[model samples]
Target: MEISKNIRESKKNILLLANKKNKGHIPSAFSIINFVYLFYENKLNINNDFILSKGHGCLALYSVLEHFNYITTEVFFSFGDFDSILGGHPHLRKNNEIKASTGSLGHGLPIAVGKALAAKINQSSKKIFCLIGDGEANEGTTWESAILADNLKLNNLICIVDNNQSQNRSIPTPNLQKKFSSFGWDVITIDGHNSNEILSVFNLNTINPLCVIMNTKKGKGIADMESNFQEWHHKGITDNLLKLYIKEIHEEAIS
Candidate 1:
Protein backbone atom coordinates (compact mmCIF):
# COMPACT_ATOMS: atom_id res chain seq x y z
CA MET A 1 0.00 0.00 0.00
CA GLU A 2 1.13 3.52 -0.75
CA ILE A 3 2.12 5.49 2.29
CA SER A 4 0.35 8.83 2.50
CA LYS A 5 2.52 11.89 2.08
CA ASN A 6 1.03 13.34 5.23
CA ILE A 7 2.03 10.29 7.28
CA ARG A 8 5.54 10.27 5.90
CA GLU A 9 6.01 13.98 6.55
CA SER A 10 4.50 13.89 10.03
CA LYS A 11 6.60 10.90 11.08
CA LYS A 12 9.79 12.62 9.95
CA ASN A 13 8.80 15.73 11.85
CA ILE A 14 8.04 13.71 14.97
CA LEU A 15 11.46 12.08 14.95
CA LEU A 16 13.16 15.45 14.45
CA LEU A 17 11.29 16.89 17.40
CA ALA A 18 12.24 13.93 19.55
CA ASN A 19 15.87 14.45 18.65
CA LYS A 20 15.70 18.16 19.42
CA LYS A 21 13.99 17.72 22.75
CA ASN A 22 16.20 14.73 23.60
CA LYS A 23 13.32 13.12 25.51
CA GLY A 24 10.13 11.34 24.49
CA HIS A 25 8.44 7.95 24.48
CA ILE A 26 9.62 7.42 20.91
CA PRO A 27 8.91 3.69 20.93
CA SER A 28 5.44 4.13 22.39
CA ALA A 29 4.71 7.03 20.07
CA PHE A 30 5.85 5.20 16.92
CA SER A 31 3.83 2.13 17.82
CA ILE A 32 0.57 4.02 17.57
CA ILE A 33 1.34 6.23 14.60
CA ASN A 34 -0.74 4.26 12.16
CA PHE A 35 -3.74 4.17 14.52
CA VAL A 36 -3.79 7.95 14.82
CA TYR A 37 -3.19 8.47 11.10
CA LEU A 38 -5.94 6.14 9.92
CA PHE A 39 -8.43 7.41 12.45
CA TYR A 40 -8.10 11.05 11.44
CA GLU A 41 -7.72 10.17 7.78
CA ASN A 42 -10.60 7.76 7.40
CA LYS A 43 -12.52 6.74 10.56
CA LEU A 44 -13.14 10.03 12.30
CA ASN A 45 -16.57 11.60 12.03
CA ILE A 46 -17.06 15.31 12.56
CA ASN A 47 -17.86 16.22 16.19
CA ASN A 48 -16.68 12.83 17.38
CA ASP A 49 -14.26 12.84 20.30
CA PHE A 50 -10.81 11.16 20.54
CA ILE A 51 -8.53 10.61 23.53
CA LEU A 52 -4.98 9.34 23.57
CA SER A 53 -5.36 7.54 26.88
CA LYS A 54 -1.74 6.52 26.82
CA GLY A 55 -0.37 10.02 27.19
CA HIS A 56 3.26 9.08 26.50
CA GLY A 57 2.21 8.38 22.93
CA CYS A 58 1.07 11.97 22.42
CA LEU A 59 3.77 12.59 19.82
CA ALA A 60 1.90 10.39 17.38
CA LEU A 61 -1.29 12.32 18.04
CA TYR A 62 0.50 15.64 17.78
CA SER A 63 2.16 14.65 14.51
CA VAL A 64 -1.12 13.62 12.91
CA LEU A 65 -2.85 16.82 14.04
CA GLU A 66 0.09 18.94 12.95
CA HIS A 67 -0.05 17.29 9.55
CA PHE A 68 -3.57 18.71 9.18
CA ASN A 69 -2.68 22.12 10.68
CA TYR A 70 -4.46 21.45 13.97
CA ILE A 71 -1.15 22.38 15.57
CA THR A 72 1.86 24.39 14.44
CA THR A 73 5.48 23.34 14.03
CA GLU A 74 6.51 25.90 16.65
CA VAL A 75 4.20 24.31 19.24
CA PHE A 76 5.15 20.81 18.20
CA PHE A 77 8.87 21.39 18.68
CA SER A 78 8.20 23.19 21.96
CA PHE A 79 7.24 19.86 23.48
CA GLY A 80 8.87 19.27 26.89
CA ASP A 81 10.34 22.78 26.95
CA PHE A 82 9.79 24.50 30.30
CA ASP A 83 6.14 25.57 30.53
CA SER A 84 5.42 24.61 26.94
CA ILE A 85 1.79 23.75 26.26
CA LEU A 86 2.97 20.46 24.90
CA GLY A 87 4.44 18.24 27.59
CA GLY A 88 5.52 14.62 27.69
CA HIS A 89 1.88 13.75 28.28
CA PRO A 90 -1.18 15.34 26.69
CA HIS A 91 -2.78 18.45 28.11
CA LEU A 92 -6.40 19.23 27.16
CA ARG A 93 -5.83 22.97 26.69
CA LYS A 94 -2.65 22.40 24.72
CA ASN A 95 -4.65 22.20 21.50
CA ASN A 96 -8.26 22.06 20.40
CA GLU A 97 -7.64 18.61 18.95
CA ILE A 98 -6.70 16.98 22.26
CA LYS A 99 -9.85 15.85 24.09
CA ALA A 100 -8.48 14.92 27.52
CA SER A 101 -5.46 15.37 29.76
CA THR A 102 -3.88 11.97 30.20
CA GLY A 103 -0.57 10.48 31.23
CA SER A 104 -1.74 8.34 34.07
CA LEU A 105 -2.44 4.83 32.94
CA GLY A 106 -6.12 3.70 33.00
CA HIS A 107 -7.63 7.19 33.16
CA GLY A 108 -8.47 7.61 29.48
CA LEU A 109 -10.91 4.73 29.04
CA PRO A 110 -13.00 5.84 32.01
CA ILE A 111 -13.09 9.39 30.72
CA ALA A 112 -14.12 8.09 27.31
CA VAL A 113 -16.85 5.99 28.88
CA GLY A 114 -18.18 9.05 30.67
CA LYS A 115 -18.22 10.99 27.43
CA ALA A 116 -19.96 8.18 25.60
CA LEU A 117 -22.55 7.88 28.37
CA ALA A 118 -23.11 11.62 28.34
CA ALA A 119 -23.62 11.55 24.58
CA LYS A 120 -26.04 8.68 24.93
CA ILE A 121 -28.01 10.49 27.62
CA ASN A 122 -28.19 13.58 25.45
CA GLN A 123 -29.14 11.32 22.52
CA SER A 124 -26.29 12.64 20.45
CA SER A 125 -24.72 10.78 17.55
CA LYS A 126 -21.17 11.47 18.66
CA LYS A 127 -18.83 8.55 19.33
CA ILE A 128 -15.90 8.47 21.73
CA PHE A 129 -12.66 6.89 20.50
CA CYS A 130 -9.87 6.17 22.96
CA LEU A 131 -6.42 4.65 22.43
CA ILE A 132 -4.78 2.78 25.30
CA GLY A 133 -1.49 0.96 25.62
CA ASP A 134 -1.26 -2.75 26.28
CA GLY A 135 0.90 -1.78 29.23
CA GLU A 136 -1.75 0.61 30.41
CA ALA A 137 -4.24 -2.23 30.34
CA ASN A 138 -2.45 -3.68 33.36
CA GLU A 139 -4.18 -1.14 35.56
CA GLY A 140 -7.25 -2.15 37.52
CA THR A 141 -9.14 0.98 36.51
CA THR A 142 -8.98 -0.15 32.90
CA TRP A 143 -10.92 -3.27 33.66
CA GLU A 144 -13.37 -1.29 35.77
CA SER A 145 -14.02 1.10 32.92
CA ALA A 146 -14.38 -1.77 30.50
CA ILE A 147 -17.00 -3.43 32.67
CA LEU A 148 -18.90 -0.20 33.18
CA ALA A 149 -18.91 0.59 29.46
CA ASP A 150 -20.38 -2.80 28.66
CA ASN A 151 -22.84 -2.79 31.57
CA LEU A 152 -24.28 0.49 30.37
CA LYS A 153 -24.33 -0.83 26.83
CA LEU A 154 -22.44 2.16 25.52
CA ASN A 155 -22.33 1.15 21.89
CA ASN A 156 -21.01 4.58 20.97
CA LEU A 157 -17.79 3.96 22.87
CA ILE A 158 -14.81 2.50 21.01
CA CYS A 159 -11.68 1.49 22.92
CA ILE A 160 -8.55 0.48 21.03
CA VAL A 161 -5.52 -1.05 22.72
CA ASP A 162 -2.13 -0.49 21.13
CA ASN A 163 -0.88 -3.96 22.04
CA ASN A 164 2.77 -3.36 21.40
CA GLN A 165 3.57 -5.82 24.24
CA SER A 166 6.60 -3.86 25.35
CA GLN A 167 5.42 -2.84 28.74
CA ASN A 168 7.91 -2.80 31.57
CA ARG A 169 5.80 -5.15 33.71
CA SER A 170 4.29 -8.55 33.21
CA ILE A 171 1.00 -8.32 31.30
CA PRO A 172 -1.84 -8.66 33.80
CA THR A 173 -4.15 -10.17 31.23
CA PRO A 174 -2.47 -12.29 28.62
CA ASN A 175 -5.60 -13.14 26.68
CA LEU A 176 -6.91 -9.71 25.75
CA GLN A 177 -9.55 -10.97 23.36
CA LYS A 178 -11.01 -13.42 25.84
CA LYS A 179 -10.89 -10.82 28.61
CA PHE A 180 -12.83 -8.22 26.59
CA SER A 181 -15.21 -10.77 25.18
CA SER A 182 -15.94 -12.00 28.71
CA PHE A 183 -16.89 -8.42 29.55
CA GLY A 184 -19.51 -8.35 26.79
CA TRP A 185 -17.54 -6.32 24.29
CA ASP A 186 -17.27 -6.93 20.57
CA VAL A 187 -13.56 -7.57 20.19
CA ILE A 188 -11.52 -7.47 16.99
CA THR A 189 -7.81 -8.23 16.86
CA ILE A 190 -5.87 -6.89 13.87
CA ASP A 191 -2.38 -6.06 12.73
CA GLY A 192 -2.01 -2.55 14.10
CA HIS A 193 0.23 -1.40 11.26
CA ASN A 194 -2.09 -2.53 8.48
CA SER A 195 -4.14 0.48 7.39
CA ASN A 196 -6.65 -1.61 5.51
CA GLU A 197 -7.51 -3.92 8.41
CA ILE A 198 -7.59 -1.00 10.83
CA LEU A 199 -9.97 0.91 8.57
CA SER A 200 -12.20 -2.10 7.99
CA VAL A 201 -13.11 -2.41 11.69
CA PHE A 202 -14.93 0.91 11.66
CA ASN A 203 -17.54 -0.56 9.37
CA LEU A 204 -18.48 -3.20 11.93
CA ASN A 205 -21.93 -2.92 13.45
CA THR A 206 -22.36 -4.47 16.86
CA ILE A 207 -24.69 -4.07 19.82
CA ASN A 208 -21.91 -3.94 22.38
CA PRO A 209 -19.12 -1.48 22.84
CA LEU A 210 -16.15 -2.15 20.51
CA CYS A 211 -12.68 -3.15 21.67
CA VAL A 212 -9.96 -3.36 19.04
CA ILE A 213 -6.67 -5.00 19.94
CA MET A 214 -4.05 -3.59 17.60
CA ASN A 215 -0.93 -5.78 17.64
CA THR A 216 2.00 -3.52 16.88
CA LYS A 217 5.77 -3.23 17.29
CA LYS A 218 7.26 -0.95 19.90
CA GLY A 219 9.68 1.02 17.73
CA LYS A 220 8.14 0.15 14.38
CA GLY A 221 10.01 1.96 11.62
CA ILE A 222 13.56 2.12 12.96
CA ALA A 223 15.33 -1.24 12.71
CA ASP A 224 17.27 -0.74 15.93
CA MET A 225 14.15 0.07 17.95
CA GLU A 226 11.70 -2.30 16.23
CA SER A 227 11.10 -4.55 19.25
CA ASN A 228 10.32 -4.17 22.94
CA PHE A 229 13.69 -2.90 23.98
CA GLN A 230 13.03 -1.36 27.40
CA GLU A 231 15.60 1.35 26.79
CA TRP A 232 13.95 2.48 23.57
CA HIS A 233 10.75 3.20 25.49
CA HIS A 234 12.24 6.61 26.28
CA LYS A 235 15.76 7.28 25.07
CA GLY A 236 17.73 10.20 23.78
CA ILE A 237 18.42 10.26 20.04
CA THR A 238 22.07 10.94 19.21
CA ASP A 239 22.91 12.97 16.09
CA ASN A 240 24.25 9.90 14.31
CA LEU A 241 21.20 7.80 15.23
CA LEU A 242 18.93 10.58 14.11
CA LYS A 243 20.63 10.70 10.71
CA LEU A 244 20.40 6.95 10.43
CA TYR A 245 16.70 6.99 11.29
CA ILE A 246 15.98 9.75 8.80
CA LYS A 247 17.76 7.82 6.07
CA GLU A 248 15.96 4.58 6.84
CA ILE A 249 12.55 6.24 7.01
CA HIS A 250 13.04 8.16 3.77
CA GLU A 251 14.21 5.02 1.99
CA GLU A 252 11.26 3.08 3.35
CA ALA A 253 8.91 5.81 2.21
CA ILE A 254 10.14 5.47 -1.37
CA SER A 255 10.37 1.67 -1.33
Candidate 2:
Protein backbone atom coordinates (compact mmCIF):
# COMPACT_ATOMS: atom_id res chain seq x y z
CA MET A 1 0.00 0.00 0.00
CA GLU A 2 1.18 3.52 -0.75
CA ILE A 3 1.66 5.49 2.46
CA SER A 4 -0.11 8.83 2.53
CA LYS A 5 2.13 11.88 2.86
CA ASN A 6 0.08 13.12 5.82
CA ILE A 7 0.66 9.86 7.66
CA ARG A 8 4.30 9.92 6.60
CA GLU A 9 4.68 13.41 8.05
CA SER A 10 2.76 12.45 11.17
CA LYS A 11 5.48 9.86 11.72
CA LYS A 12 8.02 12.68 11.82
CA ASN A 13 5.91 14.70 14.26
CA ILE A 14 5.55 11.66 16.50
CA LEU A 15 9.32 11.28 16.54
CA LEU A 16 9.87 15.01 17.01
CA LEU A 17 7.36 15.20 19.86
CA ALA A 18 9.01 12.26 21.55
CA ASN A 19 12.41 13.83 20.93
CA LYS A 20 11.18 17.06 22.48
CA LYS A 21 9.51 15.62 25.56
CA ASN A 22 11.65 12.50 25.79
CA LYS A 23 8.60 10.30 26.23
CA GLY A 24 6.71 7.76 24.06
CA HIS A 25 6.89 4.06 23.31
CA ILE A 26 7.54 4.58 19.60
CA PRO A 27 7.51 0.98 18.45
CA SER A 28 4.38 0.14 20.39
CA ALA A 29 2.73 3.26 19.01
CA PHE A 30 3.83 2.58 15.42
CA SER A 31 2.42 -0.93 15.28
CA ILE A 32 -1.19 0.22 15.53
CA ILE A 33 -1.33 3.42 13.46
CA ASN A 34 -3.18 1.92 10.53
CA PHE A 35 -5.85 0.50 12.80
CA VAL A 36 -6.57 3.86 14.40
CA TYR A 37 -6.14 5.54 11.01
CA LEU A 38 -8.98 3.52 9.58
CA PHE A 39 -11.06 3.86 12.69
CA TYR A 40 -11.09 7.64 12.56
CA GLU A 41 -11.14 7.83 8.77
CA ASN A 42 -14.29 5.74 8.74
CA LYS A 43 -15.73 8.22 11.20
CA LEU A 44 -16.87 5.48 13.53
CA ASN A 45 -16.80 8.18 16.15
CA ILE A 46 -20.32 9.17 15.14
CA ASN A 47 -21.99 6.46 17.19
CA ASN A 48 -19.08 4.43 18.52
CA ASP A 49 -16.48 4.67 21.23
CA PHE A 50 -12.80 3.67 21.10
CA ILE A 51 -10.42 2.82 23.90
CA LEU A 52 -6.72 2.43 23.56
CA SER A 53 -6.37 -0.42 25.99
CA LYS A 54 -2.63 -0.37 25.47
CA GLY A 55 -2.32 3.26 26.49
CA HIS A 56 1.39 3.37 25.72
CA GLY A 57 0.32 3.56 22.08
CA CYS A 58 -1.10 7.03 22.68
CA LEU A 59 1.31 8.60 20.21
CA ALA A 60 -0.40 6.70 17.39
CA LEU A 61 -3.82 7.88 18.52
CA TYR A 62 -2.53 11.39 19.02
CA SER A 63 -1.15 11.44 15.51
CA VAL A 64 -4.45 10.26 14.07
CA LEU A 65 -6.55 12.54 16.24
CA GLU A 66 -4.54 15.57 15.24
CA HIS A 67 -4.74 14.69 11.56
CA PHE A 68 -8.51 14.31 11.86
CA ASN A 69 -8.82 17.61 13.70
CA TYR A 70 -10.09 15.90 16.82
CA ILE A 71 -7.19 17.73 18.46
CA THR A 72 -5.26 20.80 17.50
CA THR A 73 -1.64 20.79 16.37
CA GLU A 74 -0.76 22.96 19.37
CA VAL A 75 -1.92 20.25 21.73
CA PHE A 76 -0.29 17.56 19.63
CA PHE A 77 3.20 18.94 20.19
CA SER A 78 2.53 19.66 23.86
CA PHE A 79 2.59 15.97 24.67
CA GLY A 80 4.32 15.00 27.90
CA ASP A 81 4.59 18.57 29.10
CA PHE A 82 3.50 18.99 32.71
CA ASP A 83 0.48 21.06 31.63
CA SER A 84 -0.40 19.24 28.42
CA ILE A 85 -3.83 17.67 28.02
CA LEU A 86 -2.28 14.73 26.29
CA GLY A 87 0.17 12.68 28.28
CA GLY A 88 2.04 9.39 28.12
CA HIS A 89 -1.31 7.71 28.63
CA PRO A 90 -4.92 8.51 27.72
CA HIS A 91 -6.69 10.47 30.47
CA LEU A 92 -10.44 11.07 30.66
CA ARG A 93 -10.14 14.25 32.72
CA LYS A 94 -7.72 15.72 30.20
CA ASN A 95 -9.67 14.98 26.99
CA ASN A 96 -13.19 14.01 26.08
CA GLU A 97 -12.06 12.14 22.96
CA ILE A 98 -10.10 9.85 25.23
CA LYS A 99 -12.83 7.37 26.18
CA ALA A 100 -10.97 5.96 29.14
CA SER A 101 -7.95 6.76 31.28
CA THR A 102 -5.55 3.96 30.53
CA GLY A 103 -1.94 3.22 31.38
CA SER A 104 -1.82 0.19 33.62
CA LEU A 105 -2.14 -2.82 31.35
CA GLY A 106 -5.22 -5.06 31.32
CA HIS A 107 -7.72 -2.38 32.35
CA GLY A 108 -8.94 -0.89 29.07
CA LEU A 109 -10.74 -3.93 27.74
CA PRO A 110 -12.60 -4.44 30.99
CA ILE A 111 -13.66 -0.82 30.86
CA ALA A 112 -14.66 -1.26 27.24
CA VAL A 113 -16.76 -4.28 28.22
CA GLY A 114 -18.65 -2.19 30.73
CA LYS A 115 -19.30 0.52 28.16
CA ALA A 116 -20.51 -2.02 25.62
CA LEU A 117 -22.78 -3.60 28.21
CA ALA A 118 -24.25 -0.23 29.05
CA ALA A 119 -24.77 0.56 25.39
CA LYS A 120 -26.52 -2.76 24.92
CA ILE A 121 -28.75 -2.26 27.92
CA ASN A 122 -29.62 1.26 26.87
CA GLN A 123 -30.39 -0.07 23.39
CA SER A 124 -28.07 2.55 22.05
CA SER A 125 -26.58 1.98 18.63
CA LYS A 126 -23.13 2.83 19.87
CA LYS A 127 -20.39 0.26 19.49
CA ILE A 128 -17.33 -0.02 21.68
CA PHE A 129 -13.92 -0.83 20.26
CA CYS A 130 -10.77 -1.40 22.28
CA LEU A 131 -7.21 -1.96 21.14
CA ILE A 132 -4.90 -4.01 23.34
CA GLY A 133 -1.34 -5.33 23.09
CA ASP A 134 -0.12 -8.89 22.67
CA GLY A 135 1.85 -8.64 25.89
CA GLU A 136 -1.32 -7.62 27.70
CA ALA A 137 -2.67 -11.06 26.89
CA ASN A 138 -0.37 -12.28 29.66
CA GLU A 139 -2.59 -10.49 32.11
CA GLY A 140 -5.26 -12.72 33.58
CA THR A 141 -7.70 -9.83 33.69
CA THR A 142 -7.54 -9.56 29.89
CA TRP A 143 -8.68 -13.15 29.47
CA GLU A 144 -11.28 -12.70 32.18
CA SER A 145 -12.68 -9.70 30.33
CA ALA A 146 -12.75 -11.72 27.13
CA ILE A 147 -14.74 -14.44 28.91
CA LEU A 148 -17.18 -11.90 30.26
CA ALA A 149 -17.57 -10.10 26.94
CA ASP A 150 -18.28 -13.31 25.06
CA ASN A 151 -20.66 -14.58 27.71
CA LEU A 152 -22.60 -11.38 27.58
CA LYS A 153 -22.73 -11.69 23.77
CA LEU A 154 -21.63 -8.12 23.39
CA ASN A 155 -21.87 -8.21 19.63
CA ASN A 156 -21.45 -4.45 19.67
CA LEU A 157 -17.98 -4.78 21.13
CA ILE A 158 -14.79 -5.26 19.15
CA CYS A 159 -11.39 -5.88 20.68
CA ILE A 160 -8.26 -5.66 18.62
CA VAL A 161 -5.03 -7.24 19.85
CA ASP A 162 -2.03 -5.45 18.38
CA ASN A 163 -0.17 -8.69 17.75
CA ASN A 164 3.25 -7.17 17.20
CA GLN A 165 5.11 -9.96 19.02
CA SER A 166 7.01 -7.57 21.30
CA GLN A 167 6.47 -9.88 24.25
CA ASN A 168 8.31 -12.86 22.80
CA ARG A 169 11.14 -12.22 25.21
CA SER A 170 8.74 -12.74 28.11
CA ILE A 171 5.42 -14.34 27.07
CA PRO A 172 4.23 -15.13 23.54
CA THR A 173 0.75 -15.75 22.22
CA PRO A 174 1.56 -17.98 19.26
CA ASN A 175 -2.05 -18.66 18.29
CA LEU A 176 -4.10 -15.70 19.37
CA GLN A 177 -6.87 -16.50 16.88
CA LYS A 178 -7.28 -19.96 18.34
CA LYS A 179 -7.17 -18.57 21.83
CA PHE A 180 -9.92 -16.03 21.15
CA SER A 181 -11.96 -18.64 19.36
CA SER A 182 -11.70 -20.90 22.35
CA PHE A 183 -13.09 -18.08 24.43
CA GLY A 184 -16.22 -18.12 22.19
CA TRP A 185 -15.53 -14.94 20.26
CA ASP A 186 -15.36 -14.42 16.52
CA VAL A 187 -11.70 -13.93 15.64
CA ILE A 188 -9.86 -12.68 12.58
CA THR A 189 -6.16 -12.32 11.87
CA ILE A 190 -4.72 -9.81 9.38
CA ASP A 191 -1.67 -7.80 8.48
CA GLY A 192 -1.94 -4.71 10.62
CA HIS A 193 -0.30 -2.36 8.13
CA ASN A 194 -2.82 -3.06 5.40
CA SER A 195 -5.40 -0.30 5.38
CA ASN A 196 -7.84 -2.29 3.31
CA GLU A 197 -7.70 -5.17 5.75
CA ILE A 198 -8.10 -2.86 8.69
CA LEU A 199 -11.17 -1.12 7.28
CA SER A 200 -12.78 -4.32 6.07
CA VAL A 201 -12.93 -5.73 9.60
CA PHE A 202 -15.77 -3.45 10.65
CA ASN A 203 -18.18 -5.21 8.28
CA LEU A 204 -17.44 -8.76 9.36
CA ASN A 205 -19.97 -10.90 11.20
CA THR A 206 -19.89 -10.90 14.98
CA ILE A 207 -21.22 -13.80 16.91
CA ASN A 208 -20.11 -13.01 20.41
CA PRO A 209 -17.58 -10.25 20.78
CA LEU A 210 -15.23 -9.87 17.80
CA CYS A 211 -11.51 -10.15 18.33
CA VAL A 212 -9.12 -8.94 15.65
CA ILE A 213 -5.51 -10.02 15.99
CA MET A 214 -3.55 -7.57 13.85
CA ASN A 215 -0.13 -8.97 13.01
CA THR A 216 2.09 -5.93 12.96
CA LYS A 217 5.82 -5.21 13.08
CA LYS A 218 6.99 -3.05 15.94
CA GLY A 219 8.41 0.27 14.63
CA LYS A 220 6.70 -0.40 11.31
CA GLY A 221 7.75 2.57 9.14
CA ILE A 222 11.54 2.85 9.40
CA ALA A 223 13.75 -0.16 8.60
CA ASP A 224 16.29 0.22 11.41
CA MET A 225 13.64 0.82 14.04
CA GLU A 226 11.78 -2.31 12.95
CA SER A 227 15.03 -4.25 12.95
CA ASN A 228 16.13 -3.02 16.37
CA PHE A 229 12.65 -2.62 17.79
CA GLN A 230 13.55 -3.42 21.39
CA GLU A 231 16.00 -0.52 21.55
CA TRP A 232 13.47 1.85 19.96
CA HIS A 233 10.59 0.58 22.07
CA HIS A 234 10.70 3.52 24.46
CA LYS A 235 13.74 5.37 23.13
CA GLY A 236 14.53 9.05 22.91
CA ILE A 237 16.50 9.95 19.78
CA THR A 238 19.13 12.56 19.11
CA ASP A 239 18.54 15.11 16.30
CA ASN A 240 20.94 13.37 13.91
CA LEU A 241 19.30 10.00 14.57
CA LEU A 242 15.83 11.48 14.19
CA LYS A 243 16.76 13.04 10.86
CA LEU A 244 18.13 9.76 9.60
CA TYR A 245 15.04 7.92 10.77
CA ILE A 246 12.77 10.45 9.07
CA LYS A 247 14.79 10.19 5.87
CA GLU A 248 14.46 6.41 5.96
CA ILE A 249 10.71 6.64 6.46
CA HIS A 250 10.40 9.22 3.67
CA GLU A 251 12.38 6.94 1.37
CA GLU A 252 9.98 4.10 2.14
CA ALA A 253 7.00 6.38 1.56
CA ILE A 254 8.23 7.45 -1.87
CA SER A 255 9.56 4.06 -2.89
TM-score of each: 0.94, 0.95
Q: What is the per-residue lDDT of model 2 for residues 62-169, given as tens digits with 9 covering 90 to 100?
A: 998898888999999988888999988989898778999999999999999999999989998788999999998888988899899988999999999999999878
RMSD of each: 1.9, 1.7
lDDT winner: 2
**In candidate 1, which residue ranges exceed 4 Å CA deviation?**
43-45, 253-255
Best model number under TM-score: 2
Q: How far is candidate 1 from the true structure (C-alpha RMSD, Å)?
A: 1.9
lDDT of 1 by residue, 67-155 (tens): 76777788788888897888889889877788999998889999999999999999998889899988888889989998999999999
Q: Give the TM-score of candidate 1.
A: 0.94
